[model samples]
Target chain A: MSKRSIIPGFRLSIGISVFYLSILVLIPLSIIFIKSFELSLAQFWDTIINPRVLASYRISFVTAFCAAIINTVFGLIVAWVLVRYQFPGKKIIDALVDIPFALPTAVAGIALTALYAKNGWIGSLLEPLGIKVAYSPLGIIVALTFIGIPFVVRTVQPVIEDLEKEMEEAAVMLGAYRLRTFLRVVLPTLYPALLTGFTLAFARGIGEYGSVVFISGNMPLVTEISPLLIMTKLEQYDYAGATAIAAVMLIVSFLLLLLINLLQWSMNRRMTANS
Target chain B: MAGVVRYHATTKKQTREKHIDESLVVRWTLISIAVLFITIMIILPLTVVMTEALKKGASVYFAAIAHEDAMSALRLTLITAFIAVPLNTVFGVLVAWAISKFKFRRKQLLLTLIDLPFAVSPVIAGLVFVLMFGAQSYLGPWLSEHDIKIIFAVPGIIIATLFITVPFVAREIIPLMQQQGITEEEAAVSLGAKGFQVFWRVTLPNIKWGLLYGIILCNARAMGEFGAVSVVSGHIRGRTNTLPLHVEILYNEYQFSAAFAIASLLMVLAIITLIVKAIVEWREEVQNIHL
Candidate 1:
């Protein structure tokens, strides 16, 4: 037999794929690193470590962490309800979970701003209680939570569905209570999925801009997020400063996400081996 | 006699536990909390979009969308999607075919690189292009000398969008195609069918639904992309503004009715995307059942 491969067009297809990926995704991304490297070490350090920039980083990370935690808890509940129980409008609720995915970030920002502004619907109720939802750091958390919810729900839903009912039944038969069984038996299987979802949500939250910007009121040191800061730097025509901040966000996020992905992979392997 | 009685009582307890789910009170409480959260987080914003749009009369709402800026924004949004989606579709199919069909070294690395866009911020997506093509870059001066404008123009908006949406279609198609191994294609090749014919007749039919699904999602994102487009678009009224940016400009200008009017249009598109996605999911479920 000749040593030729059975599939034809392999060369052409692979060539096109690599070229497209490089031109469209890889090369453009590398420009950020290249441009940022042009800055002197001191200048780069100053640009990324200034007081306002530090504040934005703090806000972005803290709010994203809080939002991810909140999403992890509530998203589990939402997924559990969808998978374990049947109710009226169940289909509608299931469809509604993806709205944050489908809705434009700008629209989400405006709609949320309208509903949570001091004179707005929910904001009006909270105003009497000395609470502010819009144009504050709290508002950033709200928007992040809103967008991040679907990530957790979608990631964990399949795991919940795949869980065997016999395990829960066995626990119940052995005198374990409902909550105890869930905590010991069900939650372990879901732990990796939940963590993966949380990481995904946090990563998205850090990069988020349009939705957070309007709700945040774009205050310099208080509600500004890292992505918004990048935008501000660009607007001020401070390209080097913008590139420096963007590079830092990119490197940190990429590392964190990579770590999470590796962790999830190992966990998934162990879980499957156990099963 | 006492031991037997105890055994009977334990069996009775087990039966009760098995017969019931969570207690009704607990079940209802979980259900209520989930529903309430969904309504507040999702339904409220959607309702607000519609209510605010029509808060004024329908005539005013119509006038808002019919305004010159809104009209041009809509046109630009469509043009961007129209150009970007097909190009990405072709790339997605090619990449999916190559990665799934061939056994190459560092395949996982390639997959990871494809996923890089998803991990990166959309704002960064816009910034990277500016670095490449903005006036300060090395190529920027040469391009300017040649009278080529990429940043703050239609091309800039398209490039930013193309970058942001790079992975959607490929990510979707890759998994599906990998699950479908190359046995049929091999058989076709042995039967004397050409490569193009085999791909068109055999593989294309199998991946049609997935390809369409990817296209739908990519189109929605391309049209609705705000952060990346916002950076590169330069806020040129009636020119570089996509529908989402147009909404921003109007909202910033304190024209709430016009903003919501345009936002309502986008909301409708989002709803339609969800419906299409739901249908695709249902069809997949049905197909799974058959298999």
Candidate 2:
């Protein structure tokens, strides 16, 4: 069987994939590293450490982190409802959950701004309460959370569907209460998937640009996200500064992604072993 | 003895009922929260896009969509998707096929590499291309000397889009192909079918739905991409600007109704995409049940 491969076009497939990946992804991405090298180490450090840049980072990280946390809690609830219970319009709700993935970020940005702008629908209501959503850090969280709603739901939905009810039943048979069975017996099994979803949402939130840019009001050192900072630098013809900031965002997200993959891999291994 | 046994039986039945599902109050409360969250987060924004677009009237909405700049942006967006989606679909197929059909070293690495774009910020995706083919880069001089433009042009838009969306089709198809395994193809080959014949007859039919699913998703993203395309588009109206960027331009210029009018068109596309996706998923599930 090993003497010759049975598959046809194997060589062609491998060749095209490798070549395409190199040109489209690998080669272009390497340019960031090469461009950043042109700046002296101190200059690179200074650009990223600039107070304005630091403020943007703080806003981006804090908002994205909050968005991820929010998504994890509510997304889990959504997933559980979709899996565990039947309701009117369940199918519609299931389909609607994916809108954030399908809708253009630009459209979402405008629509959200209109909704949350003072005197607008939700905004008018919030304004009466002296609460602001549009053109603030809160607005950033709103957009990030909007885009992030899908990640946790999609990740956790399948796990919930596949959950072994027998285990929960067994816990009950042992005289455990309903909430206790859920918290101790069910939630632990879901932790890995939940964490994966959280990181994915967080990573996407950190890099988000189009949706946040409008509603954020883009106030310097106040509402600017890191990705927008990269754009601001590019607009100002500060290639060195842009490259420095882009590189930093890129590395941090890559580490987060690596953690997600590790978690998924271990989860898959455990799943197969159990089966 | 009989009274004692009756008491124990009643308590046992109570425990079973309680343990099986959440109490009615808890269930309804969870449902209410999920519904309320979805309305505030997802449904309301969608309604706003449509209402705000029509706030002026039908004629204004029509004029906004028909304006030369809006028309140009729509055309450019379609063109970019026209180019990017097909190319990426082909690449996705090839990569998915290669990785699933063959075994080699560092296969995990290849999968991770494909996912790299997802992890990277969209702005950075555009920046790398700018750094590569921008006038400031090493190749910039060579490209300019050849009188060719990449960064801040249509080609740059397509390239950045390609970078951002390259993984969608492959990521969708890979696991599917992996799950289906190689048995069917081998069976066809043993029946004296050639490689191309086997693939076309056996493999293609099996993965057709999955491939369509991937293409739909890729098309949606290609058309909707804002951040990366914005970086490379240079925002030249009627020439380089795509729809998302055009929306940004109008909204920033305080043309609220017009901006939303154009945005409503894209939102329609998103809705249609969702509907189509739902149908595809339902059909796939039906097919799975039959199998």
Candidate 3:
């Protein structure tokens, strides 16, 4: 009668799901395991931790984390604005939030590169100010931000809209100040959505190449991302190394996301219990 | 009664909504900031790409667009997307139907597997296909012997794009299906409709809007896919290059206007998709209200 009945029956659908999963998911993931199997344990460790590889990992994860954090804070503000108030260009801004989602990563990257490249108008201005953007780690952050903003903004928007305003008014009527009401009342409802958006944007930025590559200038340790490092490894026919790096990324990303998911799950469960 | 609960919600929220109008000015300023970000981040750069694209004049732009390698890349991208999109759509609908309209063991596992593509990099996605279809794997030799090259061929592109994009349609459709109860199907069955007809007439019509949303997302991903497609494409200019790769080639070679011209075309298509998506989403919202 609930989530159960709506889906036909357990056994038959599970059987169908298994067949789909085997073809679609398991075999593909296993092949990565198999490819990495070519290397011994020490070789696996050596392959994944190559200095260039480590550099890429640092740049990618650091910039992605930074970008995700930026998106989380700014995106929350943006979502709050869209939800709590109506203004000129509100619908347009709402529509614009999806640009990063729909835009091609390569295209977005190229666009960012053009905007911030040495001779580019924006880049030219920044260059005169002694602030290098394109062809640096900074450029990588800008590109990732360009592509990942939508994930945070869109994810947070619906939840912000879903929040009941009466609750806010009640707290205000009870003499809680605006910031306190937001911190004590509004923030709680929006936290999980913010976390979800942050996680998704962070995950997206970590592996992002097309957008970052054009802008990063793909320097070995300076601006290169993990995915680009995998590409470089594979291009040099270092199949073992590439798969090893991928496997590491897989394991680490899986663990991290699993943690975030658990966090989200617990939060949702708490909300359900409270309500 | 349930009526009272509904009445309370409508009345309370309505009164509260009017008070919120008097609530904040900073909100609008922040929204304008968001709008500014999108404009600077997205629309401005796009306008630049277009401006640079047109600098060489129309004849040259058309010539660049008509360039054989670019033509082949565009065709190949479409060919792969066309093959992959329908297959994925069918797969998405089946998976959604099974997950939504039926119960299953390890259901969460299945959903997780389906959603894995979103979290993983597409570049890695290409590697997974290569691992299976390249010269090293079990099937690679068989596929190569058949002269049916998949790892570095059209099939490879399709498989890679499909892998990277599988979640798009299914994710879009599931929420709608959840909102839509299966009563209509049950009623159709009661009226003697077979499974096929029940699905053909009853199910498909209801979810068409959601399906379109997924398809647009899938098609866009397929066409614009660079990192994964680039890996598998072998960068063969006339052979494996998709439009994105072509743009990369032209830009790298300093054919700036030509590259932007082609890139601008793709942007036009993207803009069209965005417009269509906007409409469909609006329709979906309207439909939601009625539902």
Candidate 4:
């Protein structure tokens, strides 16, 4: 009912949105979908199931998932520290978390490579210990984790800030130990935000290119990611194949996010009902 | 009698309970992991870039700037940001207007689509533009016939960035609009203000902070975009490559000092944006306190 009050009678704005989104998002996406149609079902399967492509998928998904999981755990901590603790330069550290959000992914990749490559400073230190980070799956995980952490931290930070400290105190008074209180009370409250962060970080990691490519060393089936493989396909002029594989990536990412959201929604509902 | 007993038991619970360990192990562990990640990934890399640039000395730093490609990269980055930022700001406002003001079929779908670039792989975003404009689609033939080249060109690079950055301005403003009730707009309309006037005079001022935040975000994203632009930008020195792409090129070609010099420049811009956002947010908080 209130929606009718806001429309100031302008078709111009609405029309422009339709046109812009059509040309920019829809047309390009349709072409990608249509290109996949040009390939036979068997060819689509073949393209997606190729050893190199399969390897890239494994590298991308498994690494992204792992990075996201790592981010979920650690990002929550960072968020908690920034929100609950007051310390010197805490605001600066809080802002620093968003550096990955602003820094160009490629630049990030280059920087990470410069620092983590065998001859680079950190890599040199780790090399003596037989821990190779750059040009390996470990590098991908690090980059993804770097970019992914901010999502979780930013997501969970506000929730943590707004958390009712009195409730925790009450739980303590009710004889719940600190660990039990966290596991039973705090974790349940933070679950939705955590899931939201996980999905965002996972989605971001899955498609990340610039940062990962530099340190990844990009060996086929080793450090190669799906995005890189898609780029390789485009360079090779295999449009249909690239689109097919990309579609698969897209579907997998969407399904994972949707499933996560469903679980989050159900949890949120249950929490509301219980509280 | 039982209810009274249970209430007394609840009240006495703390008396019998053991004092809990409050070492904050889980919280501290999470914090430690984040701190470690930052130290290894961002802080160390940033230090190396700083060290590399500083080792070159101030004279070398300026000389690196005086280098031809580096200069062009700076100029090209400025040109692209100038072109992309205002366009995105205007489009983003219109998008925010449409999404926030209007209700239609699949409204949430449109919002989701607007956010697609943020979710989708930037590489995929660039690849989609190629598929659309890469001499293969219906428009590809028409665009070529009309001498409109997009892929592997400057325009293609800008478009790829545009796609990746479409959400910032709109996203920043949407929540603000929801938070700020539409009473002012209604008041303006009752005074016989036209649609454009209402937007320009009344609506813009109310949401200006949000708009500024969005513009800053758009500038950062557009300026630093690499994953999306790398696909479409042919990386032609001074021609198609944006600054980030330029940094990547220089680094790949073993121009480490020059790369860090440029990296410092962009880092300066990012830091400037950070400062501006902090000031704006602080100002907004102060205003909220007063109101």
Can you tell me which runs of candidate 4 are displaced by over 4 Å? A6-10, A256-275, B1-37, B102-105
Q: Candidate 1: where is the Cα deviation over 4 Å?
A: A1-5, A271-275, B1-20
Residue B57 of candidate 1: its Cα lDDT? 88
Question: Candidate 4, residues A1-275: lDDT per residue as tens digits?
Answer: 43566438446776787687777777776666777888899999999889999999999989999999998987877787776544456677777887888777766777788888888888889999999999999999988988896889887887776566667878899988887887887888898889888988998999999889888999998999999998888888888878998888777766765655565567568657766
The CA root-mean-square deviation of candidate 2, after full C-alpha superposition on the true structure, stands at 5.4
- Give candidate 2's whole-model lDDT: 0.90
The C-alpha interface RMSD of every prediction is 2.1, 1.2, 2.8, 2.6
Residue pairs that clash (backbone atoms under 3 angstroms), model 1: none
Q: Which ten residues in a row have the lowest lDDT in candidate 4 chain A?
A: A1-10
- Expressed as tens digits, the lDDT of each residue in A58-140 for candidate 2 is 99999999999999999999999888766898888899999998899999999899999997899999997899999999999
Superposition error at B59 for model 1 (Å):
1.1
Clashing pairs in 4: A109-A211
Residue-wise lDDT of candidate 3 within A230-273, one digit each (tens)? 88877887778889988988876776567666766776696678
Q: Which candidate's DockQ is highest?
A: 2
Best by TM-score: 2
> DockQ of all candidates, in order?
0.66, 0.77, 0.51, 0.53
List the candidates ranked by TM-score, beginning with the highest. Answer: 2, 1, 3, 4
Tell me the lDDT of model 1 at B167.
90
lDDT of 1: 0.89
Candidate 2, B1-291: lDDT as tens digits? 443454344335344355768888888899888988999999999999999999999999999999999989989899999999999998998888888887877788888889988889899999998898899889999999999999888999999999989998999889889988988887888888996787789888988888887898889899999999999989999999999999999998999999999999989988998888887887876676566
Candidate 3 lDDT at A202 equals: 90
Candidate 1 or 2, higher lDDT? 2
Chain A TM-score for predicted structure 1: 0.95
